[model samples]
Target: MNIEKLDLKSPDLVNENFEKLATLFPNCVTEGAEGKAIDFDLLKQELSHAVVEGNKERYRLEWPGKREAIVTANLPTTKTLRPVREDSVDFDNTENLYIEGDNLEVLKLLQESYLGKIKIIYIDPPYNTGKDFVYKDNFSKDAQEELIDSGQKDEYNQRLIANPETAGRYHSDWLSMMYPRLKLARNLLTDDGVIFISIDDNEVHHLRKVCDEILGEYNFVAQFIHKNNSNKNQANLVSVSCEYFLCYSRDLEVLNKEIWRIEKKGAKDIVKAFNQLKKQGLELDEVLDEIKDLYKRPKYAHLSRWNKIDEKGVFMDDNLSREGGAKDYTIINPDTGKPCPIPPRGWAKSKVELEKLREDNMIYFGDPSTPPRIKSYLTGEDLSVPDSFWYIDNSIDTRWQKQTFNSLIFENPKPLELIRLIMEMSSAKDSIILDFFSGSATSAHATFQLNTEDLGKRKFIQVQLPEFTNEKSEAYKAGYKNICEIGKERIRRAAKKIKEETKADIDYGFRVYRLDSSNMQDVYYKPQDYDQNNLDLFGDNVKSDRTADDLLAQVMLDWGLPLSLKIEQIDVSGKKVFKVAENSLYACFDSGIDEDFAKAIAQDEPLRIVFKDNGFKNDTAKTNVKQLLKQLSPETEMKVI
Candidate 1:
């Protein structure tokens, strides 16, 4: 539950025990194959297939030259121990998370435990400008192959080739990097989920297309163009002064119908206008005005009708929605008129339903001598419909970005104020948020801040690549080490601010997970050439970098796995190995599956097997795994975890 108890200390972790751990993977000893047997044709096809455009709720994934499935299948659904107050990586009450690694892998890692639970996701991914900002990643590359696969020498570990502007395939490269990431991000959202993506002209058009392809364009909510530049140079043919924020709903209409809260001002304006009309000497022994102008709100307009009030501040009252909410008269039911024809707009409550209102003496008939109204305490106020545009001066980014970019002192930032509105509109106070690019963790910041402000407990899951943060910048000059540094710092600052302002109403902390090698140990291969030092280093109990799947697998292990299980292996990312424990146990060792023969013999279940990305080979045949398991005859339970 705590760090000492569960082992999450800090960033020092990567440097401390990691290198020593990489030597333990089952395939590590294979000496790192570098052939690039990846089915380039298939990879291309998948990229072109547009999962978003295709609106794939779920799909069968299969990729070659990599074992993405293996890694994903085994990813953790729950941490072995929660990052409790003692184990907490950031704030004590925080439910936000920061993860470092390829977002695709990170998403796979999160699939099981967090599926369909996240409420919002906001990201600013690399546009894949020809200069590559993203590293081409692969899990199948063994140690030896990793060097070549990365196109680098041992001199630089974190450095990756930036997409140069000259590449003819700039768009392709960026899309390739984003394709899987966006696909995975979509899965993390709850049914009423929503995602906000920030992009520039570089890929805004493409991003929109992709959203249409994946989430269904109908789910597209709005594209807000925010001024991102003031033309420092101002010498170009056209100064592209603004960037775009693309939004999509998991199910837009439904989310919108149930989600967006009304803005306070709008609510008050409505009431104020009604009161004004009453004061204007309109003939009225009536209650609940059937004003037509009330419903005529303009799209994209920030204005609202002013409602009326006398002393206790501005107020507006509209029927909670129904038939006949309009026509009315009298507060005491006018000669026992018994609630004035049930309110034209239809009461939010039914007559029988509102019987309690009568008992509570809360319902008022009306005041011709006064303006009819409903009373709502500001403290108990749910937000009104939030404006779609998220205004920011870049003094900050959302909480996620705040932490992510804090070191850079990048002047402007989008406050969680914006994200909070979106989330509130989605009606998920404690929902999860996902940010693949996770710039400075602004989204994360917003989630935490909103939680504290509203006494809501929204959660967030942010995925950021260990993209290099230039050490020469203002942030680095301030002693910031990397982009993640900026990210973590933002959270710390945001937490402090929230506590200062809101009196610490909710958790403002976060759990941090980084993508790395798998935790599973592969039995040692042939001993190296006889050398005393080599032998000492090669001592048996080796540890590997924890993979996305490894994290997931560990989470399941921590949750307790039943021994009896059935195993099903899907070849989605790699060998999306599913371990089923009757109708219960399900594990996916999809991110690192290759030695399929041994694992097939090792288990049983009430089992289901699943993998990450795409696991199996094209027509590779699963009967082999099924028949092999039965023939081995060793049984308890089997399934995908």
Candidate 2:
């Protein structure tokens, strides 16, 4: 009989790293004082040319708890994600996910399944201001128990204020809280994926250095300045209306060094005008006059500068010469019949490119003394590249967020337009976007909103720690006990509003999973500690309090199948059976399972099958079942717990 390892937890990363290194350089891998340790002296010799040794002043970011934080990241947790079906929206059919838990442990739990799979991760972590809060890192303590004792087991108050400026381990504590989470988050990113972290002045500098070390300094994308607030409060020495988003790519080279941009809202009217004129069967000149009338509107004043119109639509003239790296080129103006005067920095386009543009009628030569310029069309993929600095006016700031909730449920909630812009630039249709620090679920709302606009099927995973709301706060009075409540309700309200307003067929649903202790019982583990006589007293190995659905969820977690997949229950001759993701896995948790049931299930040619150890009436029945499965479905992997 095979006794499967019953403990479900994150893998031991240190040994995994050693094994990977051993695979790469087997000669350098030798048995040491400790079992299966890397021979560093030999490894350094093998990589002699590239190794950097000693305390020889190399650039690095360090904090007191850095090593401990790394250990915490590498340390495995036996926690599992427990599905809360009652809290979910369209539980079985949705691709969206809402995980309520400590993000550190949650990140570890997701590492194996989601490794190198996510397309975008946008997190708005605590800025580490004295007023802000960070999770109290206590890996040894039972997090669930602590939450229960603190009256937060339902979804509240696991966060503690890490008020810096007075505490000895002020910065170190905050760094410790963020370091491991960031490391595990990087593991979840695809090769070309990108991460955006929001921070304020308090921790932006420190956060940058930490991200540089973890994500690599070369992968650094940009530190985008967001004008988050519209009203200027003369509260401090300098008006602090801006926040920053530090972006980094998993692999810049693989991204093709190219990123998409969001279409400017100011250009929507121009597109509408073009469509209207086209419907009227107007010629290019006739359309120009109508479009010119549109440009006269005060709201469309920005389009006034883009006056030139042709079959290519509205365009603005751009100087041939670039700012710094301009090339010299000669362009004979057709009107003057002579080479146009070159600008101070020479031409922006090369000779061949200039000739091509000229032939394509993209250049204008209206005057003799004036330098010729390229006509940049204002239609088609005329998306605006996000500037290093940007402003989101109050009008676009959480209109739906507040209108749906009918109250201000979250303080300083990120504007939906802001995250919509981020997702548009970084994600493709069907991309998975993860936001670990999903305060008020703005990212989730934005993902839904954008999908409706473009008809793209982008999914999202939102993780929040259930930080409690203040007793006197508006959110608390409005019936939101914690941040998770606010977050989930926001998505529900936002989805309803979007559906009612746009009539778009969008998947604005999500499955809810909460972090909890593993479903396996104490007897399953420490079997060696207990005698067979005493072990029998516990009866079944699985926890008595756990239901069949709980066991199935644990199995899904172990198999790395997404929790959002459809599940169906069927009966096989008085035994209950569960099928996950159609053919991906089949499981039976009912007792009295027999060879007949196994043979019946094997007929479907399932990829994997699992059973409870005591589910069979006898050992002979279990043995016969295995043989039957092997004969019928030789490729099926059978496991018992």
Candidate 3:
């Protein structure tokens, strides 16, 4: 009986791609020195109907390090995420996650657990304005070390390099950095998923081409223009007062065409006010007068036409005439007991539909003289398709951020309304939203606000690198030594404010995890390099300073389980056991494991189980435990670290 050891690494995407291609074209697969490899010559012939040409010229977006970027994305990582209990809000119960690390490594670790699970992704990456720094992926460590030796990188290991305009590879470096991260992000989206990227004029054209290549040009949705600032008078050429959001869908055909609508501006406030007046038992005349007065306010003035009310609700008189003259129909007015005049063009609805509308009290006639108009109820006609242009004041967001933290800790934080608008139009009530470039956690803040408004179950996953703050900046002075500190604090403040103001019963907590080296010792991965002289040196495979919680997290990642699942600690026969998601998995890292504890745990019949390699009292005890589980709980799949 063989007990398998868990592989503590991410999925090798290159091997998986080869296997997929082999399944599709068996004749094009051949065994190579490394293993099964694709014969590109034969594969090209198989895909083309005509004779294929070698090194044919084609239109493509490429840069100096494009190939290396592709290779980086296909490679697997040996890193793991260690939970930070002291920094987390509610570690055991919350589904939201806040991860701190290099986003490239973080995205690779999340490939298996969150594949095709996220519904919406919004990122506000560095705009590459020649002053801001871009992520240095360290494709070649020698090059990175050279940069560090030259004083390019700070001593804190921020993994960022400034791309000045004078640099030879200004655009190339930025493109290479964004390529692999976008490629990895695409794998985490569902069929109907969409991504929105906030960019500026500095690199919008290049970024658009990169997205078109990765997400396919046919899936391009729209380029929304946001007039965020209107007072930029310091431009040498032209005053650029706006930025852009490039939107793309994973599969355009899978999205519902009608789902891109949002409630009209100020519609919710109008409904709330109307409902309040009616609940007070005001007379119909008094209610109409009060509603008219409410619409006179500057905020609700645009919807003044919907001032009339009836037993159903507030409504506006809409023209019943069709533009091109549809079926003509007339009906008698109930108030005047006479037939109303017909519209010149014709009624929009057919005779049968018109009769149904009259029965439902959806038509209004004035004294039987004017043509009858349809009554468009506010409740039924409140939604409208969002436009491609948005005009929002930037100072409002700055003021709100100041109020939230009681200080301007972060610079140029994304507006909460902008993220909330994107989420409202793209996501569902119970969707998972991800922001890999979450600088100040605005995406998570938006998720909490939206869920509070509708009592939704939306969850968010925020990923950011712990870049050091400038010593002269206000954030550094406020004791926020890194960007991650500001982000986590902003989330806590936002959640508290929303809960206190609305008394919302939603998930107001998040679990914090930081990227680190794997829990396994070097010998566990490279046993072939050791000889008999040093064989006994590694009595245990796990590192000395690592804890059981670290081991459990890596095990969950290796087994393709989400880190947000519930975990329960159990004590049985003087040993500790972990039960995850009830019966989905069971793990025990305790020593002195015997047949009695195995029998006790086997009775639960968990689908999967894991144990430490040296946790048993003796070799005989380990063998006996395996055999006992095979007989007692035959369905349970067991493994060891």
Candidate 4:
């Protein structure tokens, strides 16, 4: 039971998010009469032509609850993540996290620690095809009121149900749900980070427009066509077998600077050609000649473009003319003894640069009737650039996903290879990937799979609300109560399988945390209202229901420390003392703590310390403890509750 002292006051998310924005663009931040506020005029100036101002028929996304959604994103929650040790794989050491909660509130909670830290975000949100559940966030209602008003009961006490097409705010409700989540998600992305959102035709356009507004229109990358559900049996009117993945970058300029590309298939063919040529007992030059000749075959016709064979190997000719802008110039053909006809976009290189190409025999002049082209060698490097079209190959498809769960526990779970490709293309070896809408935990499974394949150390943070499964559904019959249960099991199964198969040193583990009300009691919030008679009762403000471990977890969260860190308990002069992050913080919540206990803790010189105010028997004892700490660990900041 890792319950902590409840804190009623929520973390100020709006202010925190504003501070981050101010850090990025200080000129755009200005002081309001009341407090810090954004100067829209200055912000517009900073963005230059990118700013969309004035309501003069400009293109933008609109919905009934758009303003409320923005407010919901800015609104803070008094919720905290309590560790569920039994459900977790590695309770203390894993970098991966599986959070069960409303993702909007969770995103706000994560803003401070995870801001600008995530490398890739891949979310398969509800498609809002009139049957999917649209998150209803009663932004104006407090936690308890929200639960009672929504008529939801169970752990976490939130309502989730499918929104049918018959609802009046069909599209608006869906938009409202997504707007805040996307807005907060952008704050978590690194400058070069990218996001991939999977959606169907139903709301793809709305999703694009919302993303454009939140992530900036300039960052739009591509809408990739994934041919996953291509079976015509499921199509109603047209055989709509393909879905879309709308990719966007946090900053296009930053992503462009990296020059990213996905590795192409057909490397096996290149390897096969090399081996076949070797078997023919041909010399190196002869092998090159044979390979070049083989490329002309109809089966391998795509390779025919590399027609020239030289010391640099099989080479292709590229037109010498520049692309787009033209730089006109004339040059003698040398052999022809006359200048060749200039291309419309003139030569790309100057006379001196062209002379270097000629000297190195990199200019192809075999076609004397035409302008010479620069020679480009085709080495073993068979690279292909990623385009909007993503045709289905054996590696990508949902068949394996359905087979893994065995009961269609989740509909249309993404293929592991599909997500792996996104991670490989967009993230570094040690990147951190996030998926708030992590149905069936496919993103988590894929991340682990990629790590095993490349021996990389990628990590993931998965967030999903515990939406209840139908009582008569396959998942419920299998003893799973909610969607989160199924998602967790999938990850557990994936981890065990990967470990058994690879037998390699990998982090196939995750910590599970459930979002709930803070552990502090109600009296802790309105202490000023209490008279001296109740002062003694309020002395122990920590909730009686919360355990010492719970309070420690809350302190760690309030301090912005990772919740998965190892916690150590030690006995100090007959009292229990807690140490976290290897002496980074120490706390003694037990009562009857004497000067000896305080002295023992202070002697360790921990960086930060916390104690219960009534732990001491009297003021004299407390004063002695403070004096001891002041002398032994003067730098250790102390707090009392």
Candidate 5:
């Protein structure tokens, strides 16, 4: 396939000033192609600023189907990695899934069962490091009915070809690669969804723009500063210390707090309360302020007046909220070794306040032995100050992207802790989380972990290209041949970890699929003048081993439609295609798209009808397809396998 790259400089590149700086994988950023790699340095010049582009939150693609969401008891369309039975893919039994094929296609395959469902999605793609890109061929300009004609796409891509150096449109290339995929990812997130992207200075800006465009600019949550590489070599300028985590959410409002909270060491009041009650049988309030020198706070009990505590939580009353209360008070200054004078109004406890204090038994002197003092237990304010910044150490590096980019796998990859942190504060557990550039499968990891903690059944759908690895890299040694390989392994490992750790009885693994040709093979059409039996138009006619999602793509193709069209898998019917341009087509490859099924499909006045030739045992009935087409749908075009 001849790959025609557009202009070297993406002229209308509104996101950033990309003319400056060097890059590791130049192809990752470009114009009129997949996408532009982000410039992490430029994007993080300041935490709030980055190269901005189109509205970050607005999506370029509008989802087409909403009606056919249910899954049916039986399906006759294409093959999918669906659970044959409820227990087939038990949420509690297995922790990982290794799906073969394209990530985009897989995302489509998963749309039905896992919408707004994943907790995290981590992916490490071809950094567009020109030498490592490996895009599979789907078709070409020629009248090619088939290429590989297999489920697996050949490994003929950029890795073998000369690397395309970073061009003037550096960021453009990476942006193009990310945009559409990100749009698709948006659908798979739970409300409290979070996405984490791992990128250096090269194309961070482009990522931010793309994220903002698809995830909503308002959803730009936060960027975590991560030390990606520990620079040891000396340089002319400052050694770059970190990578940025581009984060966003499904919805920004209705966020929750306390999801990522760690209980602080017991507050001082807690210790005092427990010790006083258990050891002394005395309420803290009963003897808190009876008699102690201003400078003698640490050893007040040494005075020995309150030798034995007899009560717990027992206290003298203080009338603070009462009208005209707290008329008398004693003020002491420890530093000055003196007492501050009472106010002209006769201290906070004036005559009126004094009378109230006496009634509540709120005053004491010479410690508890002489008398008990008032203790206001109600004074505990909502005053625990949470640190504004999350400490890097507290962030759990999840098991994702461990073996990617050769020897560059981040061991103990940063977990979706960062994602969870951002997501919990801005989304409900059910919001969608779109992570276009998933690396190390962290987003998915975080989502799964969060689900166990949340107990709220949220779903996730991930999209990642099959970015190959350098066989010699350290990551490859750890057992991954490509970035996608690592991604799959991480999901599996995460699943296992979750199952063992949480023992959840709910479903979690994603139904895996990938981008590919339709499951239906190129129709073996005979010339119009041929006189042999038109047996092709019979039942069970489909690519013998293609995937269900692929078959859906074929349905679009035979009907002259775009492969990217939306499809829904219903519980009662199997796969349903919608937003059908020009007309509608219902196809099934099951052994028999029988008479009952045919009639079922015809329930709607579709524009066209195509089915498996094997489904019709009666030749006469097969020929009646044209007549049926006229009656069931006058405008419908009917044909057989």
Candidate 6:
């Protein structure tokens, strides 16, 4: 048996596209110099009834470097995310992740593991207001070289090129930068997943067009108007006090079928008060009176209709009549044993359904002569659909951040209430939330806060570029050299504050990872360029600076495994082994591997196992280990890196 070598690179999207086309039209799949290529003319003929021609006018959002952007999205990256144990909160057990890297490369690295898994993506990217910097994806130079060529090292880096409005490619540069990232982000969304992009007037129109092209125009859900600022005296023409959140789904039909509702504002506090009043063991009449008095307050005025209480809790009487004519039926009052008065239209439910409701004591009949009403319990009907307009004050968030850090570290962070509200509306209890453009880690902070409130197991993945802070800025003076530092620190402080307030049992920890070059040396990727005479010069294919943990991380990415899975270190025949997800995968980079160690591990019958190329004592030992595994555990597949 030939042992497989793990391909330590991100997925090749161009080949995947070719395979998809081949499956749809086999006749159009022709062999080319490199590999299977598409016969575009034949494919077009199959798709259309008329003869298809090239260079024909069609509707598309075109811009300078658009083709290059498309190429960049398709290209595979050799970058890897190495775990930072010291910076992490709970490196082994926590499911939450905070990654520092250029989001473009990070998204590509996550394509295999997180594909179609993210339920909600909320990003607060740069508004491109002429002063902000746009990410420039240049594959030609190394990261350090690019940073140096852009400006001084302490200033903005090349990845963040200043796109002033005076430049000729102002709109084009922003579009090119956003196109590839959006394309990659769409791949990570679940079928029913949704994305919320926060933007201002500067590029909302262009961004919407780009999203329509990539995420599909039919998937557009809503363009929410968030009135965040009450004071906008800097405006030239009008008081531009609101920003927008453009929401789109991967598949709108699927999302529409799912219920997207949030608890009514002030509803939870009313429930808590009702529960407290019940705990006091007051009389039912007294309890009702107290609830009514509570609802009279201005804070609970919206919930005044639900002041009535019974053994089943607070509720409001709702109309039981249906509009536009239905089958009229009499609902008997069980208390009076008489036919209750019916509305002019009809009862909303059928006879059988009405009997079910009557048996369940859901109908409220005040008098025998009056029409019966449905008792809509507050606990059962407390949810309401979110609206398109939201008015949240921006100063509230600024104040909270200042209090959390004891210093003003970030400017204009998103409101925690807004993020929590969005998550509650669109996400499930255990859904994965991603924010690739996470600035001060407000999304993660909001996730922790919401989880504490609802006891949810939702996990968050925050990715941010470690953009350098200005030398004279408060963030730098406070010992934060980069944006990622501020983001991570905010999460820590927010988690601490939330834990102290709620004392809730939840996963308040996160694992930190930093993007870096692959752990493998150049020879591992390109062995064809070397000859046997000089092969001994580079004895180990792995990098000298890389450790076992780094290799494990890269292997996980290469094998399409999530970085958040539980990882445990075990001992097998006095050799160190890394077990992930309890035998889902096992890796051991130690040397002196022989038949005894192979037999020891194969007995556990792990689903997959990996070893370093030079870990075996010799070629004979490596060949024998494969044979040993085949005989001992036929189900276990082995690989080498």
Cα lDDT of candidate 3 equals 0.85
Alpha carbon lDDT of residue 591, candidate 6?
A: 95
Candidate with better lDDT, 3 vs 5: 3
lDDT by residue for model 2 over 448-561, one digit each (tens)? 989998999999999998877899998999998888898888888788888998999979789998887778775445746787667565677776677887788778878877
Candidate 5 residue-pair clash tally: 112
Q: List the residue pairs that clash in candidate 4.
A: 3-550, 4-550, 4-551, 5-519, 5-520, 6-518, 6-519, 6-520
> In candidate 3, how many Å is residue 111 off?
0.6
User: Across residues 67-146, which tens digit of lDDT does each residue of candidate 1 receive?
Assistant: 44334434443223212223235432235667766566556666656777777777776655454376565544565677
- The global C-alpha lDDT for each of the candidates, from Candidate 1 onward, is 0.53, 0.81, 0.85, 0.79, 0.47, 0.87
- At residue 309, what lDDT does model 2 achieve? 75
Winner of 1 and 6 under TM-score: 6
Q: Which candidate is the best by lDDT?
A: 6
Q: What digit string (tens of lDDT, one per residue) describes model 5 on residues 1-641?
A: 99998778756654444544223334333233333444454344433556545434543421111011111111122433322222123332333333444554455555654566655544444455444333332322232333323223344222122226554334443444455456666776667665656655656766776677668889776775654224522568878655566667677662343244332212234335445545664444445433223114321222223332223332233322334434355433333434443334334444555446645544433232222233443211223222333334322242123222324454445545555554444445554444544545666666677678767554444455455666776667777766666776666667677878799754466544344444445556557744445555443446566544444444554455423223343322443433233235555544433444555556666676565555554676666655665667677676655
Which is better, 1 or 2, measured by lDDT?
A: 2
Compared with the true structure, what per-residue lDDT tens digits does model 6 show for residues 49-158? 89788666678776667888999899999989889989999788899999998899999999999999999999998898888998888677777777776663543232
User: Residue-wise lDDT of candidate 3 within 509-577, one digit each (tens)?
Assistant: 999988888898876437568888777757888888888888888888889888888888888787888
TM-score of each: 0.54, 0.78, 0.78, 0.74, 0.51, 0.77
Candidate numbers sorted by lDDT from highest down = 6, 3, 2, 4, 1, 5
Candidate that beats the other on lDDT, 4 or 6, i.e. the better one: 6
Please list the residue runs of candidate 2 whose C-alpha ends up more than 4 Å from where it truly belongs after superposition: 1-56, 140-159, 231-233, 257-259, 269-314, 319-339, 342-367, 523-537
User: Cα lDDT for residue 182, model 3?
Assistant: 97
- The TM-score of predicted model 4 comes to 0.74
Clashes of 1: 165
